[model samples]
Target: MSTVLFWFRNDLRLHDQPALHAALTSGATHLLPVVCLPAPDERTPWCFARVGPHRRAFTAAALRGLQQQTTVLGNPLLICQAPPAAALPQLAQAVGATTVVCEDIAAPYEQAEIAALRAAGLQVRTVWHSSLLHPADMPWPASDLPGVFTSFRQKVERAGITPAAPLPAPAQLLPPLDVPAPVLQAVGAEQGAAAIQPPAPPQGSDARSSFPYGTPGCDGSEGAVLAHLAQYLARKLPHSYKDTRNGLTGLDYSSKLSPWLATGALSPRQIYADLKAFERNHGANDGTYWLWFELLWRDYFRLLHLQYGAGLYRARGLSELPLAQHNQRGFERWCQGETGEPLVDAAMRELAATGYLSNRLRQVVASYLIYDLRGDWRAGAAWFESQLVDYDVYSNQANWLYIAGRGTDPRGGRRFNPTKQAQDHDADGSYRRLWGTA
Candidate 1:
């Protein structure tokens, strides 16, 4: 009986999971699935005061969901709290596994870990999953990638980009591999470890959380995705998506799929397909189409990171715009949600309280931090790193740079007037009352 190890990185679900399906279908009788929780580097912005409790709570919730799914499917997910470079190889050796399978991650940390594993003489296989549309499926050669999204979209449309249908969950999970768990006290969490629960749903959840914890299997499965989309679309809410997308308060205004997408509970392709179906069922309009637009934006950010890996991580900034003047006091105020602008302060407070902010507020706050407060965009990005349940390295970093005039936005820089924005988005002062006055 051959043993194969399946390492779960960001892709946590069983459905539409190409790598997991491959691992189970590889004719290996003994299969091991592992989840690793890496320790935070105290020096990194994400480690400092940046990573807030809200996103952490959300991650813990999703992990619990994954564990339950894995258990029922046969191989219980063994949790480790060590860096991937250390934990994965150890697991492979313990199980006498011939090969380790996982989804390919283009992020720097993921790339480095994979390199380390290969260097250690382990046969590692990686599959690209998560994107609604795979890069390989995109028409243009990655090297010839368009400088802007419009070109990429046009090229893909011209070439007729078609998404591969999501793979089904393995009907029979391979028998569990017998392996000793590694000692991972330094990294904090151990196998079957529980996360620290938050006081509330989370900042974003509170902003839009009519749906609370439903059942045990509600977090990381396609079933959950179907449930959410069905209820949301059934209400015909997507028809108002464009109008309410920028709203700061209430559930119906936002799609609230970030947490699921971030943890692989839902795939981008799943969302795309659902939107197409909704359009057909409920009349295609700007609202129905906006959902696809948002997914494209998500894909655009992912591609940006793939297209410019290390550059996105540099302190000099991604777009490398004119280094804005730094104001430490202003930066602090912004993070603390005390910017004196009710809208900015409310958004920051909401983030502090729940670890989520509206997309509209995210742009507003980023603009104020960079242009009005004259703070470095890197600092704003770092702040977001600390917060945001849906914080993907590519999306958050690239977005901050875009607002600060450092990234791909041809508009150069966006300077938002906090007052005007508050008046425009929260005219009734309802959002203001919820988070408190600046």
Candidate 2:
């Protein structure tokens, strides 16, 4: 029987897995499921060090969960640590795969990998699995997506483009194929480990961490995502998300879904489905169901990046607006979390110490770095790239552009006044004192 290989990237769960479903449908008796973890390279500047330790640990935990699920499905998820572009082709040949199926990733690097595999004369099928709604169901083409979020939301809402129902997992395990382990380590060996400090607290600890989630890092699994959704919905958290989302402290302040969305461990559609179900179970009110509004904001940024591509990375991003030059010392101070303002510094410190920061603080600190500090937003973005576990490229890049007066925000250059924000959000000085303010 012919074999089809399912390449697991961010979409980690078997339930509602479109790519895995496609692979299994190929009339192949033997299924090969593989995960490629890239070895950390310091020179890359975008490797594990930039990704921070907290997320790494969280991801490892998620990966363990995925392994368990895959085992129950009767196929061992082959974990390999190597650049997928370099390793996947060889693995495909070794396994004698007739076709390759994977979740479509919009990022440039991920797109390049799929193209490279197709160039090697293999049948590669990609599925849309990340969006809150599938691209096909949208009233507009992906290319025609509105540059402004409100316009996009209005058009979609007016058209009533409800998201497709999620696909269900196979009832029984797909028969496992006898294949050798791909030449990659699931965890780094001592020789390959980076020189780094100990990992920090997981997101859901309620330990007063700036950014809190149920777990840490990208573990390549879906169970953690399910747990977080269940808890947040049971208590009807979405109804209050818009109000508390801007809060600087406390566990209930934000949705904390970014990390899962960032790693593809949870799809936006899945989150939306759960949110709607919760609304049905309870009742639909602004306070109870507005979380999806926030998610649409996330989707807006994603579509913005997809529309403009590398233009969003330039100094003068989407708007082509001129930006001031970089300030090295200012950039350095901001990265070190020594910006002097108590709230700003505390937020940055929390990110450096825990690889997470609250949404309000993220905007405040980002605005300060770009406007007050006279630093390049890209530098701030790179720093964020190194530190944030939930850092999605689309959100991070587009947000930087918006702050720098170069993206979708019609009111350009909306710089956050850190002192004013600090006073309003942390009036009692509790958050400042907790982070050891001056």
On TM-score, the leading prediction is 1
Q: Please tell me which predicted candidate would have the highest lDDT against the true structure.
A: 1
Residues 323-342 of candidate 2 have per-residue lDDT tens digits of 66888888878878887878
Q: Model 1, range 1-438, lDDT digits (tens) per residue?
A: 689988888787777888988887888888888777655433454236544565556666766667777788777777776766777777777667769999887777678889998988899999888687888777665666677778777776678776777676677688886564334343334533744333343323343332232333234344566687778888998889998898777657888787678777787777777777888877888887788777877787888777888777666655554556778889889888887888888888877766677888889999988778888787788778777777777688788877877777688767788889988988888888877783
Query: Weakest 10 consecutive residues, lDDT, candidate 1?
Result: 208-217
**Per-prediction TM-score to the true structure, in the order listed:** 0.90, 0.89
The clash number for model 1 is: 6
Span of 10 residues, lowest total lDDT, candidate 2: 189-198
Cα-based lDDT at residue 363, candidate 2: 89
Candidate 1: C-alpha lDDT: 0.73
The global C-alpha lDDT for each of the candidates, from Candidate 1 onward, is 0.73, 0.72
